[model samples]
Target: MAEVSAEARIEAPAEKVWAQLTDFTAYGEWNATHTSFPNGGPDTLETGATFVENMKLMGFPAEVTWTVEELETTRVLAIRGKGPMGVNVGTRYALAADGAATTVRIDGEFTGAAVSLMAGKLKDSATAALNESLRKLAGLVT
Candidate 1:
């Protein structure tokens, strides 16, 4: 299995950050990596909720069916999904209060053939994308 994690501290309250992050319908508004996410909208965020997300990764269009695996009000959200790559991918978002800011962390992992062949490259790309998304989220919340 290959794992990739990235974190950022935003100058915003945890509630504000959580609201923006969990609002699935508006993901395309600030998430640079997502081109379109026309699935269950914001209502499809509870545990076991399923949706399809269309994203551009490394300039390629990729679509994945994702299910919310876990959710905790303003602290954590985790999603798991699979695509044609045959990998079970897990994406997690964690939030913590830091003084007057909110620290957000994103972690992802791939457990299948596609990631084993390109683990290093995938890790690098995931890190960069996570950082970019954090920057955009910060801008949106602040």
Candidate 2:
């Protein structure tokens, strides 16, 4: 299993950050891992919602069917999905508010038979992607 996380402090309120973070229409613009949602982003972000997403990881394009695991309007959104080669992936977006700024954190996990083969490379690349995603999210909301 491999786990990675990245964080950023955005000069904006949690409401603003969460709004952009969950904005499906503009998700591809700031979401590094997302290439496209074939049917479009989820109509709703509530728990139990499912969506199919096209993504690039480890230099390969994959289609993942994800289910919303958790949701808190301005606090957190987490999803779990199955990826290519029987890999189980989970990602969480966490938001913390302090005065006028929001602290955003992205957490990722990969598990299953395939993850052991390239854990190191996956960790490195995933960390970079998480950081880059945070940067893009910050740019959009702040």
Candidate 3:
């Protein structure tokens, strides 16, 4: 298994940050790993809601089937998914409101036979992607 996390403090309220985070239509503009959402971002982001997303990791394109496992408006959102080669992936976005700013943390994990083979490199790539994503997200909202 491989785990990666990144965080940023954005100069915007949690409401504004959450609004941009949940807006699938604008995701590609800020999300580093997101290449496209073939079925479009979920219309309703709730538990059990499922969607397919096209992504690029380590320069390889992959299709991931994701299900929303948890959602709390302006606070938290988590998703678990399956990708190629029997890989299992989980991602969690947590937000904390401090006065007028929002602190966002992204946590990601991967577990599978394939993941074990490239865990180190995957961790490095994912960490960088998460950091870049947070930077872009901050730019968009703040």
| Candidate 3 colliding pairs | none
- Could you give candidate 2's per-residue lDDT for residues 6-123 as a string of tens digits? 9999999999999999889899989887899999888878999999999997787989889999998899999999988999899999999988999999999999898999999999
Q: Cα miss at 42, model 3 (Å)? A: 1.2
Clashes of each: 0, 0, 0
lDDT, candidate 2, at 124: 94
Model 3, C-alpha of 47: deviation from truth (Å): 0.6
Better model by lDDT, 2 or 3? 3
Evaluate model 2: give its TM-score: 0.97
Candidate 1, residue 44: how far the Cα is off, in Å: 3.7
Clashing pairs in 2: none
Q: What is the lDDT of candidate 1?
A: 0.84
lDDT of 3 at 56: 98
**Each model's Cα RMSD:** 1.4, 0.7, 0.5
124 Cα displacement, candidate 3 (Å): 0.3
* Worst 10 contiguous positions by lDDT, candidate 3: 39-48
lDDT per residue for candidate 3 within 1-142, as digits (tens), equals 9999999999999999999999999999899999999989887899999999999999999999999999999999999999999999999999999899999999999999999999999999999999999999999998
